[model samples]
Target: MKINIPNPMFKIRAAAAILKAAVIPSNLRFPGRALVFLDMVRAATSEMAADVGNGTKSDVLMTPVTWLQDAIIEAPIVALDPEGDPIEGSELIALLETPNPFYSLEVLLAGTTLSLAIDGNAYWIVNHGRGGEKLPAEILYAPHMNMEPEWPANDPKKFITHYEYATKGQPQLIRPFGIDADDENAGVPGNVEKGLSVIHFRKGIDPDNIRKGLSPLKGLLREIWTDDAAASFTAALLKNSGVPGVVISPTDSEVNMTPEEGDAAKAKIETQFGGTNRGKPIVMLGPTKVEQFGFSPAQMDLSALRNVSEERVTAALHIHAAVVGFGAGLQSSKVGATMESMVRQSWYSGVIPLQKIIAGEVTRTLAPALGAASAEFDNKGVQALRENEDLKAARIGRLYRDGVLTRADARSALNFETVDADNVYLSNLATTFIPQGQAAPPPSNGNGADPKGILARLQDPAESLTNLLKAHGFASPAAMLAQLGLVDPGEV
Candidate 1:
């Protein structure tokens, strides 16, 4: 009666166990580095050109995106002191105005920061031109694709950087970070400590890929898939009218054909009548009639489907659809004079944060050298100047009334130059009352005389009335009452 049996729990555990061989291969990862590398290149080269107009005019001009990038780069950003006052004509401001030989301060800062904002990574090579000192003479943009970052001992901050660059007909060479401007051995490696300036910009969540910033467009790959599907649907709209699958017709009903004959007939019909031939007249031979089958995208409204993909792109860019003329329904939402205000508010709100980030980076890097206590970025040309006149006036007036700001501060807030007289503060006065030094005028009576003499100079209005009928509808209150009562019209 003895028998060997496997335990039910053991069998269950064996069935549920994950085998090493069953694990997914590393190569089978859905998205590989190749796609990310490609996107990095695209982001780097996104604003390469601007198109102003048709032909040469347009060719010479920059595109909207490029223009926007340039504006951000070239914007006149001033450095402010600890008191929020601009430090004009300072070395720091000048450095920011023009960072390097090839590019202006605005351009360098804008381009680099934008690159970091959009692509999540940017690099710069600090060149100490002429007599080598700690001060950075020129900051040059280094291509992310060309630079291979190395971390010795797996330290995030400690890294040996080399840039692989080659011109036409020249052998590709690895150039190390921080080569002396005058050094003949600049192209050779081993200059790691001398010139490496690597900024992480924005860190990604994945510790394994800490060197690279998490791209804002990382979600775009999924969006692109939806775009691809939409494009395919559109193409299908042209071919099969959005229908999927083929039409099968029972052979003419009157005549029978072999499989070869049926296939040949189908091919012949397709070549002559499919795609562009759709909606055209069809002439039948004998009793044969053509019939269409299967469901198509056009039948289900292709535009409605495509809008979803368009919205995904809009959301990824974090821009208003109206800015690029993209409407909620395949066209941009209605843009009018009123919408301009909304657009400006949206744009400035987005830009100010980036501006602050850029300013912080610049100040942190250059403040020590420039001998400045602290620095702040001025939004002068951007928001301060562009504010509505009435709104600006109201803001200044409110501040002046509240005594929270001096006259000079109010004027400065309104973008006006300060006057010596405007510098005085009236903080001691009640917020609702005028200041102590300023004299308050006495209260005026209805007559232009002292309030005490008003009763003495009074006169009867009836005595002054020479023309009774012209002056009043009735001569007096008593006369009017008599006409209506017993004293009658005869007495009048």
Candidate 2:
């Protein structure tokens, strides 16, 4: 054999090809597929922009979203200690009070909530102090549409290496928490060394792309489109004097015209009868007849269709139609739903859960950076989140009377501060306590009573018997009393 050896350059080329295949994702390997994927992303982004734009214009979409945003903004941000209790007068609270120079905490919270509702993602840029300070100096809100996460080459375990923030100028590269400005693996070339990090708050995971969040509006896109189309149709009808369309033709079939004549007739009819000329009384000759085409507003039943679409949209956003004062929700209110109950339901199902997610994310990311154990949105100040005071007081009173909770615990449950006397359990004057295995005292006799002449006490015969049995050996007097039916079991 002539010692046929493979060329070194060929071996190098083969190894390079294998390495490239392994390192680059398959979608990126083919230029056509990559372009297709890019187009898909562009389409998705356009859809998201349209959803948010249209949502802002439509009351059906914006009502619930604004309600939620207002609720979130009204709540205060609290820093927590290691024991999960709110830390009083912490630096974290001070920083949060004025998160940045341009906006207040409320504006930040409102923007974040609105973004989560619209884009399903919110981003915050944390600018750490230049003098080696652990806490951030300023927190800047980044629009979700402009922020994107980047990952290293084919690294599944390292899902995100850094965040790429697109600006009007050059795009800024922000490292995640733990990566310093000087870190070798901070990100791609031209990564800024300004010690910036990003905090991403996503509504939930996207099944299609685990790296991204799925917008709540995704499923309701068709419904939104339908609502918009219906609105446009209704507006058009109103503009046309409540008429959908009209057909202008000769009443007699014998009155056929040339194509040029037909075009001229159509132009003349539009000039005099369209838009502002609607219902101006068309002047026709030669037995011409005008017939209305398309469905009228009544025939379309636009109200019912819009109401249904509104209900679906509100439901997807975790808000009842009644809470948003939509027709469908108002109809339900006529049946049984109350505004208060609907508001509470919205808080429980929509606002609180969203607050928890945002708070939990803050606790995980911003709190530790600021040397705090946790950070949470305090809804205690929000009236909508509060329980009915009357019902709460009654429940607490019942629990206190039963000796299940101390005065301090009950007060705490009601969001009241405790006093020194609050450590004791509440004692009911009506309750007569008997020691274990001891007999209850007999009812007082009227003989030799005090000069005040207090009435003699009388005890239920069943109670006396039950007390006697308890003194002897019976385990539960309440059970025995229930069987006898002499005393109310609840009272016992």
Candidate 3:
């Protein structure tokens, strides 16, 4: 029985081995001259390294070395030959196993690639990266941010206008979200759909974008977080954010009616780590007198929020963890279509998906990260070439003539298959992907990148493969696309 994974979006095609034979360091000799640039990637020394790629970054909470490397050491492995170090491969195998945990991901660009000689002979492969790790300066956003059912409103999600601090007159006035004043009767706005709630800068010098600023995570956000509506100022002055800085109290968690033990926890904060960074961040959240700032937990449809929260968190952490090598290599090299799924995960990192980040396709952002010294690659000065029509055409033509493509060369290139006028090369692949492309790669079709082309190919994998190589000007888009099918086609 064919399981047509709804949307056919779950295909996992990377397993065919996108990785080519290793480029051993010894074979490619370094020039006599020496050049050194900035030293951003220090040797792995931080205790953070031990727990990185795993959720338990905190030593206090980490129970095991769960990253992909350690996990592989435990997986079953076999020796290929005496030269490749059959026994040694088992030890190095640690680098090949583990589960990916990225909720976000970034690549290692402009850095030294790690290599290992295989079979004690001349074979080699990139085992790890040693530098160039940069997360986008701006946080990648998911299509929608999940909220607790208790969140401010219950309608369609709304966007922000601007974040304002203490406004003219009164205790405070938030422009688009909400406002808060010294008077308790100022009134709190209920959660309204297509609207917002505000967090008044009641204290002073607020620095966050109430809209985008994420706090230092105290270990991935707790699945259940409630902002009590009735909570009052005096109660806060008395106690503080409870251990984990929170009590499971829901509506009672608000500022108004003061739950019995609730106030006790606030007082407890003062009693223990009173008045210091060690104490809570000492922040207050409430309805903006106007629905201009953020959202009010008061109006949320708790049921929907609860469901959304769980689903959103799961989607988010999975994607987020994938992008930044979260559980990559720490577990497995995103086996087969999993890498496809991993790439798709980036779109779920926040409330709005990045225009540049999407699933079932490759994006320009995937371009091989240029090394710090890319300026000198001297590959016909292509690197120095400016972006324009001529450059695009030339590059596309070059790749087409040379038959080089990004679907990654297959371990076994097909033979004698009388290439039809519409000769396709790779059918195993599913793409709109070709990292460095221009005016005429097989997929280019003189129309530049078709981000959604793969979805179109989804209907008939066979026919699409036949017509693929003719895409753009690539010598064989078919081979490129076909190769993408290395892994199973239904799991990505």
| Whole-model Cα lDDT of every candidate shown, in order | 0.48, 0.69, 0.27
Candidate 3 residue lDDT tens string, 1-492: 111112221222221111111111123222221234562544532333333332333221121112211221221322112222233333222221221232212211100000000000010112112221231122111111111112122221222322223324532212222222122222222322122222111111113222232222222333322111112322443354322233323343354545775687567656665655463554334431211332233442344334333343334323333333433222554474565444333322321121111111111111111111001011122211223445555665555445463222221121123322223234322234545655436534333565545446556556454455555444454444343443333332
TM-score for each predicted model, relative to the true structure = 0.50, 0.66, 0.17
Which regions in candidate 2 have their CA more than 4 angstroms from the true location? 1-59, 129-134, 185-190, 241-296, 335-337, 405-492
Cα TM-score of candidate 1 = 0.50
Superior candidate under lDDT, 2 versus 3: 2
Against the true structure, candidate 2 reaches a TM-score of 0.66
Q: In angstroms, give how far residue 238 of model 3 lies from its true place.
A: 32
Q: Write the residue-wise lDDT of candidate 1 on 31-81 in tens digits.
A: 112234343545422322211111122211112234335445534665544
Candidates sorted by lDDT, best first: 2, 1, 3
**TM-score, cand. 3 vs. native:** 0.17
